[model samples]
Target: MPTPIIIDCDPGHDDAIAILLALAHPGELDIRGITTVGGNQILDKITDNALKILSFVNADIPVAKGAAAPLLGKLVTGEEAHGESGMDGPALPASKFKPVEQGAVEFMLEIIRASEEKITLVPTAPLTNIALLITAYPEVKERIEKISLMGGGLAYGNVTRTAEFNIYVDPEAARIVFESGIPIVMSGLDVTDKAAIFEEEIQELKTRGPVSVMVGELLDFYSIYGKKMGFVGNALHDPCAIAWLLHPELFESEHLYVTVETEGKLTRGMTVADRRKKPDQPANTEVLLGVDREAFIKLLFDSLERLDRQLGSPAGES
Candidate 1:
């Protein structure tokens, strides 16, 4: 049986690829729906980008818009990275899928309550939407199998000198999710940065076939922003969470007690993972520490190629 999952994202460039990966690996994952949050850009843009990307892949997943900001703090958008449109890569055809009226949090609760099997929550953006769902409907907590989120870092940070973008955007929400007692598998920058998507791979994506070509164009557009950020290459951040579902062996993780800094002015949104020597806090998350980049990228590109070959064009491809 395929693992049923719900992707909560902000449609960052890598988020686009994450959707494609989920669509490609049908047996490994059953996407219940897509929920958009405001992190990379804003609620409207992220929702639009979610539909656009899924449509691009010809995936028929429903989409819902979530919170426009965090639980208590002002929403800090990542215009520097994802651009004004959230997903600024290749010209995506206009989205044919409109967002449902229930909103992301409600939609998440509805599906989990209705499904007989537990649903995995893969949150690749800020935790606002996920946190909201858990808080608004505490009864559904038992229905959630786990939350696989892409944020925080064991070592470095991108948004601040100590925090990653997703968590940094909404530290309070992150704090709630960490303390919510649901099992979490955190695919932070610690592992994601290790899985860099570089130029050679991009070339392969371009010439490997037509589907590869589309992925290549998306990456090409994605890379321009990366170059400006001194990445020298792209980090498959969002996709790492989806990849975790398909290929868990590519990454190394440790069971640890993880908490979010919600009130500290200097460390807000920072994941306070207790990687300490002989600690007493109950470990709640499997925090990924490293990844086999070569294998990881190979899986991604190959999967996209497979989808392209099968469908000929993205579902929304004109």
Candidate 2:
């Protein structure tokens, strides 16, 4: 049987691809629901982007609006990167799908409690919703299989000198989740920065299908910053979480004692990974340090090919 999972996202350019990648592997992942939080954009924008993207792909997954702000601070979005629309490049149809009436926490509680199996959470956004879930309903902690999240890093940071964007957006919430005792798989910048999908790949991807074209266009806009930084390609950051869930063998990881720095003067939102010679605390996060970039990209391409098969020909292929 496929493993049950929930995707909590912010619809960053990479977040949309992550959802498509997960959707393609219906046999491996029984996606129970998707919850949207404020990160790449505001809750309203990201949530609508989620609905529109799923509608484009004809997926039936339930979506719920999540935290509009962090647990303790004002919301800050990655709008400078993702643009005003959040998903700027894709000219998607207006969403025919409406999110479930309940908020994200309640929707998550309902899905988790009703699932016969423990649900793994794929959080490609800030930790706000997850923290609220566990804090409000402590009993649900035992029902979670694990949290496979795209944030933090052992030695790299995207948003601050020592902080990654997702965790940096909501350090208080991240702190709560990191300390919650649930097993975690951290697909942080250490691996994700290496998970770049380059120029030629994006160009070729556009010809594959409707989904591929959408993804390719999103990547086109997304690659500007990476290219400016002189990276070989754009980092497909959020997709690393789903990739880890599907193909753990493609990545090398270290079991480290990790904590979120909520109150550091210069390192707030930094994930303090204890890589000491002999640490007292037990390992809390499976910190992804390296990845087989070739195999990981192949996995993404193959998944998109599978999705292409499910739909009709791409536009202009008639």
Maximum-lDDT candidate:
2
Question: How much does candidate 2 score in TM-score?
Answer: 0.97
Q: Give the clashing pairs for model 1.
A: 57-315, 58-315
The local distance difference test score of each candidate is 0.85, 0.92
Error of 2 at 150 (Å): 0.3
Per-residue lDDT of model 2, residues 95-147, tens digit only: 99999999999999999999999999999999999999999999999999999
Between which residue pairs do clashes occur in model 2?
none
Question: Can you write out model 1's per-residue Cα lDDT over 77-138, one digit (the tens) per residue?
Answer: 88777677877767778987899999888899889988999999999999999888888899
Q: How much lDDT does candidate 1 score? A: 0.85
Those runs of model 1 whose alpha carbons end farther than 4 Å from true positions after fitting are: 277-280, 313-318
Q: Please give the clash total of every predicted structure, in order.
A: 2, 0
| TM agreement with the true structure for every prediction | 0.94, 0.97
Worst 10 residues of 1 by lDDT: 309-318
